[model samples]
Target: MHPMLNIAIRAVRQAGNIMTKYYEKMDSIESKQKGYHEFMTYVEKETRYQMIAIILKSYPQHTIITTDNNTMHTGDQHVQWIINALDGSINYIKRLPHFSISIAIRIKGRSEIAVVYDPIRNELFRAWRGHGTQLNGYRLRGGMVRDLEKAILSTNCSFKMNPNASPYIKIIEKIFTQCADFRRHGSVALDLAYIASGRIDGYLAINLAPCDFAAGELLIREAGGLVTDLTGSHDYFYNGNFVSGNVRIVKALLAHIRVK
Candidate 1:
């Protein structure tokens, strides 16, 4: 294992332990609204602080980016550690055990390592740049379903009225017609990890931050899958809209999406 990846795994696992300790006492945890339909709790802050501490201790000179502040690049720019301490905060607050801790290491602006750990399930999904993705130390591969009718897709949906809601719903309806089913999981990190593990055939989401899917993106790609923007391009990192799956599933999905 790479030294940096080892440190990341240590940090994420420590953070996951913190979250698991708090998961059992949801009623006592207080949460505040961070944005429209977004919530934050002390668990996130504590876990973030713990993970950062562990990481900076190992590499004090490396740049660290979190969801709270992604643009502040002060430390060594050559290596960046992007972290989402609690990927599904809303679900955590609601006692839904489907959340994860996502950590991605980008060297020279290219993702080199990724780790997504689910504490409740005790499943660790990790990947190196050239190595394939793994779940609990076993190699993972994306689903082989090439046809949409045989695929089960995952996505994140917002109930609040927003400009993109109508268009997003329309796209979902169109895909629903062809796909076997859709699952609206609150965690994009887990969704992408699922794609890598073959739990879901594909995933699509709009308006997400890099912290949300950075780790999972690398996982999918390393696991013999593809990740691209809604337009079937490699601009998802900038556009914040991505569709990920095996090559055939992703191409089929792009064919159904009407990108305007």
Candidate 2:
């Protein structure tokens, strides 16, 4: 593993340990809504703090961008860390055990490392640019479900926050008709990891933050899959939309989306 990626792995694991300490007592964690269909808890805040400390201890000069509503940048830097200390907060609060800690390192405008750790399953999904995606050190080649009719696609219901979900709903309805099935896992990071591991053939969503897909995007691409925004561009970091999968499935999914 690249030295930076190794540091990231250590960071995520330590953070996962912190989260797991609170997992069993999450029901008493005190929570609030961040927005429509969104939730946050004190656990997230504490975990983010510890994770940031771990990363900075190793590379204090790196820039850090996080979804905790915190952004820090200083000095000349070629590397930046994008993180979601706790992805799938709702699932975590609901005791679903499907949440994860996501961390991705972007160097000089290009993503070079990614890690998503599911504490419940003790599964770690990781990738480095030009290196294969791995699950607990085993390399993954992604899925081969090219035929749209037989592919399983995953998405999130965050469209509820959008003024009009009809257009997005239309896209889902169309996909349901053509694909074997679709899922809304509530964790965009895990959804994309599943895509890379071949557990799912594709994933799509809109109005997501950079922290939501940064790690997953690199994992999918490194695992021999493709990722892009609805516009078929690789600029999802700014656009906050995604459609990722094997080349054939992504193109097929894109053909069905008629975003107004």
Candidate 3:
């Protein structure tokens, strides 16, 4: 693993420990949205505080982008840490063991590293620009499921409010009619990691943000999974939409959509 990627993995594991320490505690839960509850507990806050402090201390000049609503940076530097300190907040609040701490670094608007830690499972997924994806230091790759009729897929319902969601759904609805099964776990970070680990055959989403996908994109590619815009372009980062899977199946899924 790259030295920077090693640091990223450490940070993600540390954040996972912090978050897990507070998991399933009734006192820390709070409502955040119509369909969401949050644990913005001291654990989440302090973990991010520590992670960001560590990043700034080590890479003082690099700008940090996060989901905390606490920091923002313009497009000035060549490096940025895009993070969702606590993803699957609703699941976390419900004590469902599905949340994660997602951290990815984008250099010049392109993802170069990403680390996501599944606290409940103690599974750590990490990838660097040229290195293959890894799970606990072992190399990984997407699964070999050629037919959508035999593939397991995932998507996010939260994306429905976006402009592309309808069309994206139109494509996915077809998958439901043809694929083996589909699921929505509410965490894009984990979904991408699952693709890299071969836990899911393919994944699609609309309105995914840079912080939401940058790391996962590189990881999926490194893991030998195919990723592209729904329209078959490789420019998924800017397009805000992507469909990824085992190489052969990804090609088939991409054939189902036309988006730019």
What clash count goes with each model? 0, 0, 0
The top-ranked prediction according to TM-score is 1
TM, every model? 0.93, 0.91, 0.87
Q: Lowest lDDT 10-mer window, candidate 3? A: 29-38
Best by lDDT: 1
Count clashing pairs, candidate 2. 0
Question: Worst lDDT window (10 residues) for model 2?
Answer: 29-38
Two-way TM-score contest, 1 vs 2, winner: 1
lDDT of 2 by residue, 182-247 (tens): 888889899999999999998988778889889999999999999989989887888788899999
Per-residue C-alpha lDDT of model 3 across residues 128-237, encoded as one tens digit per residue: 87878898889897787888889999987554556646766677777678789898997888999999988999998876777777778788988988888877887777
Off by over 4 Å in 2: 27-40, 73-77, 158-162, 258-260
lDDT tens digits by residue: candidate 1, 124-209: 99999998899989999878888889999998876466775988888888889999999988888999999999999999888888
Model 3 Cα RMSD, 1 decimal:
3.5
Q: Each model's C-alpha lDDT?
A: 0.87, 0.85, 0.77
